[model samples]
Target: MSKNYVLSLYNKMGKLPFGKKLFSLFASNKAPYFKTVSPLITKVVPSECHCLIKKRRKVENHIGTVHVIAIANGLEMAMGFMAEASIPTHLRWIPKGMDLQYTAKAGSDIRCVALLENNQWQVGDLPVEVTAYDENDVVVVKGIIHLWVSEKPKK
Candidate 1:
């Protein structure tokens, strides 16, 4: 079978120098709201996605820390990519809800990871676990992004 579209793109683009940046840019363009965090997608594969968001003024709150909303944006972006890479060809998914907690101060650049188990790829309210860590590897944020999965409509 042909590779999933998103994974195929990543496999090809992920080989070139600065390809990850380009791919992340392309993705952000497709979903404009995700641009708020300026996420750099580092890895994309079945069941998991990794992303990095630098702690810049644009993403920082008045307290000079990465904003909660910015971290949420990164988490959502990672989850979206992971879902795209993991879902079965006959199925599709959309975000239904998100529940997140700010566990610690994000004092540095953040790494966001979104993960789903193989069996969790079925239809229903699939909750993809997501976590954001600071430079020191402290869990700065953690949550679930709920997705509604269903068979794709007939063409």
Candidate 2:
């Protein structure tokens, strides 16, 4: 798709209530990050995005703390949002790997925020490192996103 077309679509989609759902429709099964975040994401700003997921009673483990995997999931989703926003429509991206550390017990809501530099990025291979924090502002997880770009890759 043309850059102009994609940017225009994003602008239009941004106005809709279900703007985030648009990602699901396009990627569907491969869009797990979108599914995980769409419901909890409260806001998306220029160069940054904020997500919120409540610590439900059901989501807690035996110790009454939120599951470690749940927190990791939120971090990945937030990072994905940042990475996606950084790339152009002609490119594609995926989570290469992540290194996370669970500090304190998560008894309340978890928020993941991703920020990007406002400067323009030239279209090419890109990898973004995103860090997620708990309600107490302690780092809970970190991810290194590796994104591959190609007009066409060998199939």
RMSD of each: 1.0, 4.4
lDDT of 2 by residue, 34-96 (tens): 454333554454445556667777557899876767776666666565555555555566555
Best by TM-score: 1
Root-mean-square deviation of Cα positions for candidate 1 versus the true structure, in angstroms: 1.0
C-alpha RMSD (angstroms) for model 2: 4.4
**What TM-score does candidate 2 get on C-alpha atoms?**
0.63
lDDT of each: 0.93, 0.57
Worst 10 residues of 2 by lDDT: 1-10
Going through the candidates in the order shown, the clash numbers are: 0, 0
Clash pairs, candidate 1, are: none
lDDT of 2: 0.57
Which residues of candidate 1, in runs, are more than 4 Å off?
none
